[model samples]
Target: MSKPSYSKGLVGVIAGESAICTVGTGQGLNYRGYNVNDLAEHSTFEEVSHLLLYGHLPNKRQLEQYIRRLANFRQLSTAMRAVLEQLPGSSHPMDIMRTAASVMGSFEPEDENPNNEKQRNNQWECGDRLIAIFGPALLYWYQYHKNGTKIETRTGPNDTVAQNFVKLLLQTDNPDPNMVRAVDVSLILYAEHDFAASTFGAIVTTSTLSDVYSSVCTAIGTLRGPLHGGANEAAYRLISQFKTPDEAEQGLLKLLKEKKIVMGFGHRVYRKGDPRSPIVRDWARKLSEIINTPYAKNLYAVAERMEQVMMREKKMFTNLDFYASIVYHFCHIPTDFFTPVFVIARTSGWVSHIIEQRQDNKLMRPISIYTGPDPAKTPYVPIDKRLERSKL
Candidate 1:
């Protein structure tokens, strides 16, 4: 056989085709051929979710109907709520998301027939339902643990996904409109990125013709790693440790001198810079200004200083997670809940990719070149023989 080409971490490997979202294209990221910038600036998170899931931006009547449909699905079944309530308080919020998705699957199992038209349509509805309810599920568990109360999941029918999340999370009837807008835009920015780790994980599960919920559960687990969706939380922790921009600059330099990896400063795909960074940075700046607290101001300053130091010393650019740290902070979202919010937005992308993968169904099985002892020649030694060999 010819020598097998190796790419560590599958870097630069084109594993499959997708039309859901495009990343690192020369013009920047696009979802369903709609530029990310346009979507973030002019659209709501609900609109973006609809665009991503349904394959086109909805007109006025369609959008209103879609929003109502999503709102209707936001309530969790009693059994699902019971599952969330019983999860240990010490559990990582991402784990709560994983368990919640999996449990929801049991309550509402997808049809097993991958080729069934009705089952396919049911998958799309399941995707939408997950996108709508994940926020409520997360907040229900969060409040149940923190406050020892079962807060209502259905805040209202008029709230957008972003608005509903903030309201449910903070237990407030009215949140700051700017804060709501900031969170919404962040959701829009995060709604999709082509073939990201979590999306790929979801795709791999779906390629086996698995249920959509199982695919999303796979995505949540994949995103829990520090190298992926957890980076924002890591970035926030790093930025919060310093009180001043100078201190942040000094701290970053020391870490770099020691050859430590910075959590949010690099990307696997975007060498020029993450196109989403500037947009989120703008929101971070706005939130800092609006809060106008010494701590908020300091955090934003520290983040900026870190970005400058990373670029100056290492020629590395900030990714979305870098500025997103500051944005989530100003929204008053807890540090631990950062990646769960990521899961909520990314559900749209993950489900869309899962559906796309099913359309061009292929089992994503790749062969690995063997480097160990020859399979035919290798013999299994008994425990006694292995022990004797070690002794000799």
Candidate 2:
């Protein structure tokens, strides 16, 4: 019997072993028992970090200290800063992040002893290291090339991730309060998804007994492509290319006529629609208002209409990428840094999957029915004898 083709998107098929969270009817995504939408409103990114790491939301006292922990753990090792400073300033932000994460693993390994008391402390520190320094590491290396001048990352201790990141990037302590809130909400929106392609990529990496940094680096690299996390950047590019929804619609129709795929228009999972669309979309809309960008307004209109049209025409619904593009754009994120922010948020899920995979670690090598030439045949080609095949 021939292999049956999947319904094009692995929509309902089990692609691999996953004890990580799962998405189900209505595109509902949860980690453990906590709903993602609820968490986005009620919790900060730091609290969500606690949830993913400790398996539950912290109570009042626990949460207070946990917040303190995140704040206190914000400093980067001097060596790490030095390393970031020394990197050839002309590197891609994602490359800089991946390199920094890997190097951080070398310098800061988490507690490996399964039963060690230091495990909790070590894990928290490790996460704080990633969360706290990721922006500084990328921006420091970035500005070194752009300006040939070193940038100071600390803005005299901004408390929140968004605030600190803005201060670090802008070299100013006076980050807008609303801007920080929006960026923080964006991080919450992106923090976790149930076994997304790149998160699965992280799980598979950890299943090989690799370190967390390596697993996260792998996830980042995997997310940097158009088929996955790169869709946000692609969506931004597409919107930027067109001046209005009318133009975007015309371009989209032309492309569809030519049988070309539109970036961020559809998804493999959401046959009906991505439930996250309205949530993230509204945030972008609000931020567009706050930021006062004509591009944001036009992009929002274009994306909404495109989603409506694509659903009517192709039956493929908009996924997280569509709205995420507008939100990232509103956040003033560089197009290239699109997926790195994704990496920052999704690291929690990556760590969760890493822990899950380690629970019963097994190599994820799947077997296929061998249908190629059998091993018994001995076929050798002489180097001088070649067949000249005509191009079709």
- Output the number of the lDDT-best candidate: 1
- Over 188-224, each residue of candidate 1 has an lDDT whose tens digit, in order, gives 9889998989998988888887889989999999999
What are the models' TM-scores?
Answer: 0.96, 0.87
- After superposition, which runs of candidate 1 have C-alpha atoms over 4 Å from their true positions? 1-3, 114-119, 388-392
**Model 2, span 1-392: residue lDDT tens:** 78745444445666556534556655377656677778777888877777887678889888777766655555667887778877776676778888888878888876676573223336546766687678777777767777776776655432777777766666666777766776777777677776778887887787777777888888888877778878888887877787777887788788889998888776565565666677787787887787776766777788777877777788777777777777777766678888777777777777777766776677777555566775679477687886787995
Q: Cα deviation in Å at residue 89, candidate 2? A: 3.3
Q: What shift in Å separates residue 248 of candidate 2 from its native position after superposition?
A: 1.2
